[model samples]
Target chain A: MASPEIEELTQALSRLPGLGPRSARRAVLHLLKKRESALEPLLRALDAVNERLVTCSLCGNVDTVDPCGICADPRRDARALCVVEDVADLWALDKSRLFPGRFHVLGGRLSALEGVRPEDLSIDALVARVEAGGIDEVVLAMNATLEGQTTAHYLAERLERFPVRLTQLAHGVPVGGELDYLDEGTLAQALRARRPLG
Target chain B: MASPEIEELTQALSRLPGLGPRSARRAVLHLLKKRESALEPLLRALDAVNERLVTCSLCGNVDTVDPCGICADPRRDARALCVVEDVADLWALDKSRLFPGRFHVLGGRLSALEGVRPEDLSIDALVARVEAGGIDEVVLAMNATLEGQTTAHYLAERLERFPVRLTQLAHGVPVGGELDYLDEGTLAQALRARRPLG
Candidate 1:
């Protein structure tokens, strides 16, 4: 019923995460209605990102610059390196303003089912960065998933010979979580890793 | 944590309907990761739609052409016209392929609460089209909302003197609707307009 161009636009929008065909159509209509405000700005932003964005050589994070803003920032603690399964994870951690350190994106977790091996990830680069020596701590901030834990274990074994101290994010009940609603595994982990109140 | 350009992109994406900040961030990450397959195609589609799409002067429908594909088609029943509240509604009705007639978009319904008046819509243009003659029936396919009904009544009064026959969509229980789950208003309408056995 819509023009081919409009249909194509809707199809393209539906490819985005969390947006289905019905909502994509609505979004397209909204874009068409507010062409100057929504459509034009989005176009400009996409063009700028597509043209200027590049993956960091030192870390796998994406940024407008090659080294990335986080990697190049002198204020960050260069001694502490955070290893994550993906750039999204890196962004999520950095957005909190905690974790005052540089990041190394592992590209993906080690998944035996999916055939994702150690070489498929940026594990070699991570080890090389740790081996180069100034990093005092390597924090494995991989997700709590089984594959993520496997990847962290593999990285720890490879970096054990290095001078850097290895650590991983603690598994426990989340902040503001209700005890009744949490899974049994989380409850057990929280109990095992209990800390004394200050 | 993200570059200025990526942040701007996420902000722009968040402006879309049905998408919030977190989902928009995820969408941006997906786009950046699949730049060749997803991002470029979306950009190209948006650019094409922005450059070529236009609202039909005759029917108020949006398309790449002046009269729109429906209006330009000689196979459509020009004698029967379907009046809708918005272009989206027109596209939706047309997508079903159930409405064989051409459509006239009123841009929006008459909402006194929202300060939307008859003059604010394409009512005058619609009246002009009906006055041009040859139309036999005008289907008032407005939404079931109070504002939509009010607009339909106003349009009916305006087009009363025209040679065209005015009609409206039948109000009743929707297809596949269970009586237990339906609202009182719909149940009443369905009972009142209940069809006799063949």
Candidate 2:
């Protein structure tokens, strides 16, 4: 089909989150077509991130700077530390602009079956950060999945030595989610955490 | 939140097919995680493709070499020419290894509504390619869409001046397509082109 180089490119692109073989080929062709505006800039950008980007020592977030955007922001409440399962979750919360605080990425959850233990995550470092003081609250903003809950519960017990207040995202139907489509667990939680309506 | 460089990379990657903003960010993170295996190799491959690859003068196919792999292959059937709408189509046909012929990329189809005239495509070069040589057959392997059909018809009429046989791909229920899901036009075509069991 294509040359060895193009095939190599397609192979690399297929490793990405959503792209597969066919879509990788399409992406290569597209990049070739839009060489200057899209491809060149993307190449430069990828190289830049690869060369300069490093994880923030304080929060485990990837950034060019040492402290990352969130950790460095003075306006964000340092006392309100948001704990997430991964970097993607951190970004999602950041995009919403609701959580006016810093973050500590666990790297992953405590999945014993998958061999992901507390040591494998940033639990030690996070506890140390909380133990160092000044953090008034710890937001356990993990997904409502089994792994997420397990990780959250484990962290709560581990961080019991610290005085930080712990909280988790409410389990319920998503904002745009219909009740019919929601699972029974979410319905039950929503019912239990019933709030007064306007 | 991520730094400026990660954001820039995400923005660029989001432009690629199959990647939105969130997926692009995920891809960046994945690359960061698999820096040695996926990221570095991809960067090198992309740069290699950008620096070296060029379109074949004879066939309009993209390749690192001057005449492209297909055009340069001595064993290929030079007399059998397959015409397609774009490089992507050419690659698709080539990947199957079913078409042992050379290719001529039309760049695009004739769209009167979009003001894409015959000149807008590489129709002149294609006509010249057919007019000059000993091409036994011309396979119009365009898509089974209105635009593809229109271009094929126009090319057929134009190539009527030459002594080559012009053909098109058969329209039928795809190999894995279910009978229940097939439309009337396809069903009629399949019935009309039905082959007897040997």
Candidate 3:
């Protein structure tokens, strides 16, 4: 019932991660209604990102620059490298500001179900980075999912020959998590890795 | 931790309906990963819609051409005018193919809380269209909500002087609705407007 351009716009929007057909239509309507405030800004932003954005050759992270801001920053701890399944995970970890290190995006996890292998990821590059030598620690910051853990374990074996220390994120109850709501595996991990009081 | 362009893109996406900050970030990452297939197509589609889309001066419906497809269509019943609160509603109604007529978008409902008056909508233009003649029926296809009903009532009053038959959508149970799950208001409406068996 809408114009072809509007329908096409809605179809494109629905392909995004969070938006479905219904929501995409609503979003398109909203954009059409507020062309100056919403549509134009979004268009400009998308255009800018599309024109300027580039993948970091060193770590596989996407940014406006070749090496990315994180990789080029002199203040970040180059010795501590964080390996992640995807750029989104890298962004999430970096947003915390707790890991004062650079990142290596694996591009994807080792998914046996989907037939994703180590060869498909940037595993060779990660090993080469560790072997080339300034890195003292390699944090495998993959998600706690089965595939993520499997990838981390595989990476550990590959990087074990190197002089760098290998580690993964600890499994525990979340900060504001209720004990009753906590799952068995998490509670067990949290209890088993109990820390000493200051 | 993302680049400024990427950050701007995420912020713009988050402003869209049904998309929040986290989802927007995920969407941006998805776009970055699939630049060729997803991002480029979306950009092209948005650009096309932005550049070519125009609102129909007569009815406020948006299209690639002036007067819109519905308003310009020779096959459509020009004598039957479907009045809607928004273009989205117009599209929805038209999608059903039940309303074989042209439409007039009121822009928004008459919401006293939001300070939206009749003057703010396309009510004056609607009245002018009716006064110009040839319209036999004016279907007030507003939503069943309080505000929608109020807007329909206001439009009915304004168009009462015209020879056109002013009508509204029936208030009752939906096509596949169950009595157990239905609200009291809907149930009462369904009972009041119940039709005899064939």
Candidate 4:
């Protein structure tokens, strides 16, 4: 009989972005071996995140509290908004320390094949936030994929009439680059977004 | 002014194998996003493991309870012992289901420069267990590193006086191949251990 515990562990690990069955098995074995030092802490971290972390009500980024540390911080620039595909992308941009603005996590891009539409993203909420008046510029940091481009275009059209400036994160994002692969999509977007830099 | 919480998290994550500062940051971000899905469960698992796990007095393998299941199981063959460098090696052997014997975890190899002497390993205990009688074989499954080889040679010599059979894991470990890199080192060992197909 296949042990359900192992099967569950394998399945759980396999769901990770890069891990597969073999790697999952290896990781599980590592945990089993170093139970006290490695496994215990990992499990604790997992539980803590599950029990305590909440999504920011405004931007959809994860945080220990609603609205997240970034969104809640009054020191951050409210006039600028950085849009990202996922929480991981937000973190990537955060590490660069280039953006003092708040973030909006779209969760994913607009994909016809995947049935992900603009409504499927956080764009509607983003548009509403922008129309509320304080946000001076909305930077489209969505990926360069077909779906990302489509989502960005949709958002651009929706935000066109707003008093705020509408700008797409620029050409620095490689043809196939994902936000995870780009360091500070904010800075790259800023440089490429400069007026008449051409 | 370092936030103690950030410090705690950073230190905890850095302790994980292969996780450097960059990886740890990325991991923390990822955990923050999927807090409920991964973080909470991981935290609970960690606490459970830490609170419940203990080292097997016999083999030094980690388990939720003392005298780990393998060591307590009467069905296992005590006569045939598998000597491995780390508990991870023990798990690999167990997963293969090829060896029904008990195990001895050396904790680490004999690295003279690293000051890991023979006594530092559980070699003495292994020798004592073998000398106590009833043991049919002692298979040295230490890593194929220079230190591992040195340790194995030392064990082979120490156990030579005993009536028990003395054998190693059999080489052909593909020089640079780490134990984790091998799908199943037990299988690889068995194959390399085979004496002429004929």
Label model 2 with its docking quality class. Answer: medium
Across all candidates, the chain A TM-score values are 0.89, 0.90, 0.93, 0.82
lDDT score for candidate 4 against the true structure: 0.73
Residue range B58-100, candidate 1, lDDT tens digits: 9999998998999999999999999999899998899999988
Q: Cα deviation in Å at residue A47, candidate 3?
A: 0.6
The DockQ-derived docking category for candidate 3 is high
Instruction: Report, to 2 decimal places, the DockQ of model 3.
Output: 0.85
lDDT of 2 by residue, A1-198 (tens): 788889889999998989999899889988987889888998999899889988889988887788887788999888899999888888889988999989999998888789998888899899889999999999998888899999899999998777878888887778999999989999999999999997
Among all windows of 10 consecutive residues in model 1 chain A, the one with the lowest summed lDDT is A63-72
Q: Write the per-residue lDDT of candidate 3 for residues A1-198, one digit (tens) a residue.
A: 888898899999999999999999999999999999999999999999999999999999998888888999999999999999999888889889999989999999999999999999999999999999999999999999889999999999999999998988988989999999988989999999999998
Off by over 4 Å in 1: A112-115, A173-181, B112-115, B176-181
Model 2 CA lDDT for position B8? 88
**C-alpha TM-score for every candidate:** 0.91, 0.89, 0.95, 0.74
What is the C-alpha local distance difference test score of each model? 0.94, 0.89, 0.94, 0.73
lDDT (Cα, tens digit) per residue for candidate 2, span B112-195: 889999998889999999999799899998888889999999999999999999999998889999999999889999999999
Segments in model 4 whose C-alpha atoms lie over 4 Å from true places: A1-14, A19-48, A75-77, A92-100, A113-115, A144-147, A170-198, B1-11, B112-115, B170-198
Write down the TM-score for model 1. 0.91
Candidate 2 overall lDDT versus native: 0.89
**lDDT tens digits by residue: candidate 4, B21-108:** 6666665666565656855554544455456666778887767657778888899998999899986678778888899988898888
lDDT of 2 at A30: 87
lDDT for each residue of candidate 4 in A80-180, tens digit (9 for 90 to 100)? 99888987678778878888898999888888898877776787888789878888888888876777778888888888899877776546656666667
